[model samples]
Target: MPTPAATTTDLTGRLAVVTGAANGIGRASAIHLARNGADVVLIDIHESGLAETAEEIGRLRRAAHPMRVDCTDNAQIVDAFQRIEREIKSVDILLNNVGQSARERASEFWCSEPETWDFILKLNLYTAMTCSRQVVPGMRERRSGKIISIASEAAYMGSQGVADYAAAKAGIIGLTRALARELAPFHVNVNAVCPGPIRTAAADRLPIWEQYLKETPMGFAGEPQDVANVVVFFASDQSRYITGQSLIVNGGRWWS
Candidate 1:
């Protein structure tokens, strides 16, 4: 039988791939993993942010490869994974982090447009589907891998204006749970982290900050690290027995 996976949190000698890693939770997660001794691959569409993240990874003395790709583009997704297999060699962990909600104030669902719906579905939903597909082969071959995705509380709470965003993120949760059941026999764990009101520049521009604040019992917005910490646990063997589960990192905001 294959040896048991490491239950400790140390990621030395492991390789991790994080999507949407230009800033916020993505950036924090990449650095945190690197600090714990994992070589990281950062993927995002923002060239400047990717460069900055790469430079910081360099300072940490861990290998960081930045790949720029429009998350919605299937061809670019394939190319990114091919480069990862060629350059990074293997993917011990995959963090599906590319996502966004439309920047607008509260409005009725009727105001949602098809263009917006399509954009939200592609970024928040399809990106994870494609990226996860890319890594499953290698993981299945080795009979081990960790897949951690960044979902959101809006998925469960049902944010009114960003209905598309909520639906897409909810789809991620469904994907994680379903994939976990299939991948479990291969020793690959799949789980998701649902963050609430993370205080990032993007969050600042959110139209419903007050709504989030009122929902959060902690009386403050969560930071990127708050979400990243749970991600690290899920990515490591520390969460070996946990699968098909979604953890809400909202500091007691939403229980579901």
Candidate 2:
């Protein structure tokens, strides 16, 4: 088998923008890109974690710019992207990784509250839209770009409590498909990755995550790198012909 480095060219001059990159799969993906020679721009709401992530990437001798911005805010997203373009030059890759989940509870379309419903949509779906819209214009101008959104397995399998989050993620899947079709003419590939049972700090807070792992086909919880590796594939030339698809890194949890 070819070494991972041999599978992708040196991304030395390429600029990559990764949102929610302060920790978890986002952090791993940003680091992986840097290891392979891509200059990375890390954006997250968590300023301290962003700083730590940037420092680690710097240790790899790769250029890393860490910024704090609310991805759900349109003006903030616009300003951040423009600043990155001006300072880092251009963005060749965009990873929309910002996501949040609320405590799951019994609910149906009939009993859902408006506040929870809008919060889920605004945080998950609108955030991705704001970031994608900012980076895509320049990508279209260059006639080349790669965009990846991190989704979740619940969107497909239907989690019991997080109805709002699942609906938002399902919307992300649709958005990925639509954007891929629209941007195909510009040579931009857009896709989403659905990760299940990855052991992150946040995962520790949820009791259901362990139950999900107990039922996984692989019989083990995943590490951040497992998901990061797939994201790297979608962002690289190896996946040039792939678009509008959702690659599940759930270790056979859902089989689809």
Top-lDDT structure, candidate number: 1
The most accurate candidate by TM-score is 1
**Tens-digit lDDT track for model 1 on 1-256?**
6777556789999999999999999999998888888999999999999999999989999999998988889999999899888866889999999998877633567976888888888998999999999999889889999999999888998877888889999999999999999999999999999988899999998777877888778888989988888988998878988999999888687542
Residue 163 alpha-carbon offset, candidate 2, angstroms: 0.9
Return the clash pairs for model 2, or none.
Answer: 104-161, 105-161
Q: Give the TM-score (vs. native) of candidate 2.
A: 0.92
Stretch of 10 with least lDDT, candidate 2? 1-10
**Local accuracy of candidate 2 as per-residue lDDT tens digits, 1-256:** 2443435645678888999999998999999988878889999999999999999999999999999988767788889988987877888998989887865533665788888888778878998988898888988999999999999998999876788888999999999999999999998999999988899988877867778888899998999899888887888888877999998888898732
Per-residue lDDT of 235 in model 2:
83
User: Each candidate's lDDT (Cα)?
Assistant: 0.89, 0.87
lDDT of 1 at 138: 85
How far in Å is the alpha carbon of 128 misplaced in model 2?
A: 0.8
Lowest summed-lDDT stretch of 10 residues in model 1?
103-112
Evaluated at residue 168, the lDDT of candidate 2 is 93
lDDT, residue 185, candidate 2:
93
